[model samples]
Target: MFNIVKKMPKALWIVVLAHGVTDLSAGALLVALPFLKAKFALSYAEVSAIALMQNFTSSVSQPLFGYFSDRSPRPWLMPVGCLLSGVAMVASLLAPHYYLTLLFTAITGLGMAAFHPEAAKTANRLSGKAKGKGVSLFAVGGNGGFAIGSLLLATLLYSNVSTGVLFYILPYALLGIPLIQMTRNLPRPEVKQVGSLKTLRASINWPLLSLLGMVLSRSTVAAGISTFVPLYYVSYLHGSEMYASSLLTVYLATSALGTLFGGAMSDRFGSKRVMLYSILPISILLYLFPIVGDVGAFVVLSCASILLSATFTSSLVLAQKMMPNNVGMASGLTIGLSVGLGAMGVLALGKVADIWGMPVIFTILACLPVVGFVLTLFVEEPEEETVSLVVQVSK
Candidate 1:
């Protein structure tokens, strides 16, 4: 019997925990936003714009952070990123005006952008022989954090906004201390560091570029679905907020499980094969999502969520391997650019949903993975020489 917990590294575990807490804080903020919207008399469009600002900050900053972390001596970038993001989350709670709220949200996004590329790069480096598993474990933290944050914040909101915001501070403070301690004890790897822009440009290998395209397309679908699922359930299915929220929880939780499965499977098989197989099922489920009614939509969405998340893990593992020298840059493009840009699709899909209907918007989203799957055929896996070149440039 395989003892998964025992085999994982302490550092990986710590990173995962930090990732979760950071995500949880972000998620809590997201869930709490509706309350703020009601209190401030903001329109749906206004609320969405605030959310978009957050996504924009995260998307723009990730690559920049990746570029710097690759060359910087500070091994504490990931932990510091987490701490700053947590502080930003708390700051948002203090915002007295809409503009200030948006500013703080953007700051939180910056924090998130800073943590991921550096932390993911570190996780990939530590995984070495089992990079897939390592990335998967790291991803699970984010997924679980999103789930926990939503649930916890929603529960706390029943009392008051202040209470909900205050609840998060304890977790952040507790988690930050250990992360600081762990980072101090860890030794930095010896590698030739690349110049910021030059390294980032050079790290963009053919395989990595193809994978980034895949990430973007898949992200379009993932982001659209996540942002709209709650509204879709409420409007189309006549579901209660609690039930709709539960469905979202199911989606995130299963996605976490999928990350674990996909990561481990990639280690045993190959990243390409795992990615190829997962996309078909994801596409099929996504296509089926709009047509299905009531509880059936939830079931199909759950299946689609798992496949989508699993493919994400596979893509991350493959991209990291392709640019082993610049794992931060690789991680930035895969998670930061791909996922972040994808989240931005919410704006477009929202417009489409406004005009055509939610089903049509989803049907459009369903096609993204098929594009990604086809692109997968053209993407060649990275070779040893390419990885070595990347390593040299990264140094």
Candidate 2:
């Protein structure tokens, strides 16, 4: 393990750490936002709307940023975006009213949106044979951040909200210093000469687009569960706040394990096969979640978490292979658009929960991975490319 870490590039390590810290800050915000809503006397609908704004803004802008990043020379876009996002988060501390808070949160989301395309593009470029491992490692940073943030926020909420808010700034400030050093030493990326979207659309392989759609659908389920599982446990099962939060931690931690496994499997077997096999088990587990009582629910949630997240790296690797010329855009679509748009499913499922109950929502989410499984059939594995001058130089 030490030898393997030694072999990885310094830039990749920096990106991973930076990704983790940024995500940690974001996670802190996610966990604390609910409390903030309660303190402000906001409705559940209003709280959901804030989340919708964050997702909507992030999803729409990501593809555009990704498209431009592919054509641009500025590899520093990642760090700059991170910096702006951190600043935006700091500014959000001053939001005295709910509307102002939403605006600041949206700005923070835009900053996050900006970083992803450039950072993911960099990861794809650096990851040669073990693309899955690389992506998985990056993802683990985000997940770890999320887990830690959730745990810390839950703990702090017992005391004072101001303490949690103040602690959020620490990670971002610490990360900014190292980002400067990493930015200076990085190699310059060559700009691609891809034509307009029409030509690009003509050039796009349909199988790849189908794969994107599968990811989009899968994201709906994943995001819905991630955003609301705690609420379900709390409201439907009459679980304590700590228990609900603990289940969420269990879900996230298991998902991290799944991510690691997915990346490893994709590197060994093909990404498509790994994804295809993982989906059915995940669907089955999710479908079974609400029907089970106490211990059974926890067991099922853990399993679902692992299987669902395991698909993440494989799905991303598949996209990167499909669009070798525009990896930034591809990564953005898979990681950003699919994941971001998937958050909408939370709102949709929330409505379903309101009408029918938690069981129905899980049943609806279960169908998504099956759809992804069917879509996986159409994706063709990328053929080994003849090593062109650009490919050679990129390495």
Candidate 3:
């Protein structure tokens, strides 16, 4: 494992760590939410408002940033976005009024929107032939951040200085300088005008719909599990909050490992193949997830987690290639837009759980991955756009 990492470029390493820092802040916010709620005496609806604003802003802005980055190649968006994410989160936490906190959350989301598309574009360019590997390493950073962010925030809670959360900004602030210096020397986009809406629509064909469906389905299952698995642990398995949360941690940690493993495998085996295999088994595992005995359920759910996570890099890399000319747009749509849309899909499933109960919901969630698997059957391997782009650059 150490040797494999040693072979990766220094730039990718920096990007990965930067990604981790950015996502860590997002996770810490969730962890801090209960504390904030208690301190401010905020209602559940009020607490939810902050999340809504952040996600909504992030959803709307990501593709906009992608479109702009594609047209203009503003590499500075990368570092600027990073700085904004950290600063805005710190600001949001410290803001006196509830409305002010809401405003800061939106701004922090804007920073995330700025971060993903541009940074993903940079990672795509830097990836060379190992695009899957590069993006997987990048994906793991977000997973690691989410996993650790809670722990970090909990540790700091003892300090009784919620204001001290400001310190987390240092990683991105310091790293952003070098990232700016390094990416400035990287490849430039070909100087063609970005197509108008009509042409862009024409450029997007059937495969995009297929990919979107797959992304939506995958996101639905992920959101459902993240939201409900802990509930299952407590309500069904008769476990403590600590044990329930640890189950989530286990899923996330395994997924982080799976992301890198999947990426390396995809590079060797083809992204489409890896995705097909990763998702097809998911439906079966998910079906077993809620039906088994306690120990059996845990085993099944863990398998599902690992399989789904394994496809993270492959999916993103595939999306970028499928729309080679509009990679920034592709990256934004795939990572940010899909994720946002997918989160919404989970909301719909929440309604289902209300109507039909969790067993029914889990079964539905299990079946959703089949949509992704079937979509994979029709979607072709992308034209070797990465290779062709390199050739064009050398000329």
Model 3 scores a TM of 0.92
Best candidate, lDDT-wise? Answer: 1
Task: Give me the overall lDDT of model 3.
Answer: 0.77
Q: Sort every candidate by lDDT, greatest first.
A: 1, 3, 2
Candidate 2 local lDDT, 207-240, one digit each (tens): 9877887888778877878767888778887779
Report the error of model 3 at residue 270, Å: 1.4
Q: What TM-score would each prediction reach against the true structure?
A: 0.92, 0.89, 0.92
> Model 3, 195-242: lDDT tens per residue?
235434644877777776787778778888888888766875677888
The superposed Cα distance between candidate 3 and the true structure at residue 320, in angstroms, equals 0.9
Which residue window of length 10 is worst by lDDT in model 2?
Answer: 386-395
How many angstroms is residue 356 displaced in model 1 relative to the true structure, after the best TM-score fit?
2.0
Q: Rate the local accuracy (lDDT) of all candidates.
A: 0.79, 0.74, 0.77
Model 1 Cα RMSD, Å?
2.4
lDDT of candidate 1 over 183-286, digit per residue (tens): 78766675555546665676566666778888888898887777788998798767799978787778866787788888888888888999899887777887
Each prediction's RMSD to truth: 2.4, 3.2, 2.7
Better of 2 and 3 by TM-score: 3
Q: Give the range of the ten consecutive residues with the poorest summed lDDT in model 1.
A: 1-10
lDDT of 3 at 168: 66
